[model samples]
Target: MTLVPYQGDALAHTRTWTTLHDEELRRRAVKAAGEKDTATLVSLTLAYLTQKGGSGVLTSPRTVEAYALGTRQFVEYAAANAVNLLRPGRHDAQHYINHMLAAGRKPAGVQLKVAAASCLYRALRWAGATDVDPFRDASVPKDRTPGIVKRPPYSEDDLQDVLEKANTHEKFLLFLIAHAGLRISEALALTWDDLDEQGRRLHVRSGKGRKARVVAMSTSLARAARQYRQQYGPGGPHHLGGRRATPPEHVFRYGSTFTARYHLSKAFQAAGVTFRGFHPGRKYAGTRLIQQIKDFGRVAAHLGHESVDTTRKGYAQLAADDLKGDLAGW
Candidate 1:
């Protein structure tokens, strides 16, 4: 079997691959069969999935890219040791994990890399491109760091202080994440049209796994958004920072996630609060919602999670707080 070189560019490949069928995958397998090196074979598999949308196996571009990167790392490691990535066995998987540990990669980072490789193998298997999944039984290292300190949620006073310190742009971003329980990615992805003016709901189009959901906006959030629109002209594609944007851009355009984090940290420091991260705002929202509603399912839905268990795991510490209150009553 001779693997033909992928002839598609990034944009075309992304658009075309989402609609791939099984017959096309079989044909692709023939084209990929001639590749002698495991690197090429791994690359071919990723290209096919990237183009084919991984048939729900890969979920999103970010996920596919992560897996591709992980597979590349594995392939390079295997090549140095004269091993074939495509035909790797359990021992090869273990060796890769050991190598990552030896190279000082954090347990969580190595875990993600291993998961990425596992996902690639799973995708290939689903596409009928390969039968071997070396990472099937790989033992991912656990973080043994003592006394892992979880970030505490900002108190209401702390949150308000931070908000008061932030400029309009920063305030809006913080409010959306803190009040609405939006991930930074989701808040940034919002467009003007995603807001239902009359209905008072926010349409989150790019939740994890690219799931879309409509979350009812609080009266305060709705008022803030309206005020923001009036102050900043609403001609742009995005509701936030798209006015100066070329076209079809995100709302708040930081250069990168790190830049956003830096701005957020600055805001917290200005307010004289300890800066944990924007995620603590999410934790604050989760804890409040779970406490108020006492319904994990409702909290999960509000947070755009697929399962209540996810919501529970995130806000489990709140349960301890609840128990403390109960103990006081007793």
Candidate 2:
């Protein structure tokens, strides 16, 4: 029941719809979605959420994927119960949430799906698509996962243990987060060109929520990186041999991001340390730096964080006993 001839045109069932900003097209499509079956609107609305003009912020693909997964799950649930996916009321949303909880879904998983569904509705309502925002003001429960500290940061000894056990790719990756305070995604997106002056300086191009920054490398890291360059530098097997010959290839040139995280977990297992995720590695770098320098601003700058307060609150995991001497005069 498409209001437009989308079935015969290029915008039938693809992201090509994203490029067209015709208000009439949007109005017609959304109007039909409300009156008729919303079967195709699921993908259309999900794809629309990624548009900057639609969702405000051009959401990252990873985030968009999560949104799609949750939205589709909600659509499936609505279909099973004969609930309207496009026009669900607040009670319908609450019922779906309660159903998930009763079915033994974790609190965090429920929250994620709910959040995604909310985003979907938000996108539609923004464009006057449905005038139905069922998730708005919907009751969402707090995550009651049993853990005092969600993910505990690694200690210096813990990092050393993992470093010793890690393979070449894993070792370098661990250094990026544990020593240099880079996000795992940032490290995975690294290219040979990001290193400067023989790895004495590093250009972090994949910073989260901020522009790029250049960080200076320690003597030991620089030396190790230099050695890595000699081993896998230009013309090496992982260098520039693929279809993207013009662009610099990724430093950790794995086939896909699928196997990259597995390497880190394997190292953690061998080192007998719990895999607390890659964020703990950045936490290690921040906490260790804060301990040595005793300055939140310096540590924040080193970690590429925007604020000293963020560094102090989130990353600087200094024990009160260890900081007693440093704080005595202050």
Candidate 3:
């Protein structure tokens, strides 16, 4: 019943548990909980939740992994300090939050860690393992400092430089984010079948919140897709992949999301452009589309936002800048 190190991928652990039969999952949980050890108890409960679809418990793979890591942190903290995690009270939750803050963790990071601990307790309660929820009303500190300074969207000239210097695959990725306004995750999740050659559209099967939509592709992007397909052979379900003859299920096979970002950043560096991650491309696309259409609702729909308010809030700075000229004439 030794607690395993939590360094490996939590998603991999979740996926393994999810593929097991219910009885097997229960057997594994039982084996892990050979004793009444608190760490083992938390691990077994998480395993059970991962196997049972995590409904009200763990939501997505990212969330599952985040919670698992957070729980391990908490469990390690408890073991070190000789605190009883299984029956923790509100004070214990507050202490954990304060401890993370004292360790120089960012306020947002501390909040997420607290949230993960809260979710773990909720899952344990649902599994009938714990009766107390310490994080139910824990007073987590707010990030009162001025919000993070987001890097401004690339200027037209810088964007042009990026487009000119990008290689074939890199160019496609840039176009998807910059011109089409696809989020990095959405762009990476695209497949050859999502492309509509006749209609010149790209279908986003499942976007944020499991919503789906179709977005019109620029003529240049459509032409590039056709050329890319012809040159590399039609990719697998994912629109991008490794240089090998056979494509994988995902777009970038560079291990993880961070690796993909590193490659993109390298391309930007090579182009002599400031690299601010992919979101700036999306912001550039949104700003340009808003100026072109002059319709917030239309812009919202194009960006796959359920509400125009959301779109407006996200682009408030751009909106203000766009209105300056109109206000000057008035």
| Tens digits of per-residue lDDT for model 1, 1-330 | 344334555555443433468778645543443233454455554665655553444355566567677767765676687665446655988888888899988888899888766765665665676688787777876665421124456678998998889876677677787778888778867877787656888899989877898887777677777765655535633445433332344455443456678878888899999987777888777778877878888878878889877677654245546767568967
Q: Candidate 2 versus the native: TM-score?
A: 0.76
Per-residue alpha-carbon lDDT of candidate 3 for residues 1-330, written as tens digits (9 for 90 to 100): 265543445455555455657666555444433333555555654655555543523355556667777877876777676666556655887888889889899888898888667766655554454567887777767765422133356778888887787777677777788877887767767766787756889998757666889998888778766765555434433344335332454344443456668767777888898888877777777778777878878777877888887666554235447778678968
Please list the C-alpha lDDT of all candidates, in the order they appear.
0.68, 0.69, 0.66
Question: What count of clashes does model 3 give?
Answer: 0
lDDT of 2 by residue, 270-323 (tens): 999988788888887888887787888888888888987777767876666985
Worst 10 residues of 1 by lDDT: 241-250
Q: Output the TM-score of candidate 1.
A: 0.72
List runs of model 1 lying over 4 Å from the truth: 1-11, 14-42, 51-58, 80-82, 101-108, 122-131, 141-158, 196-200, 235-259, 262-265, 272-277, 319-330
> Which of candidates 1 and 3 is the stronger one according to TM-score?
3
How close to the true structure is residue 220 of candidate 1, measured as C-alpha lDDT?
A: 66
Stretches off by above 4 angstroms in model 2 are 1-15, 18-42, 53-58, 98-111, 126-128, 141-148, 197-199, 235-248, 307-313, 326-330
Highest TM-score: which candidate?
A: 2
Candidate closer to the true structure by lDDT (higher is better), 1 or 3: 1
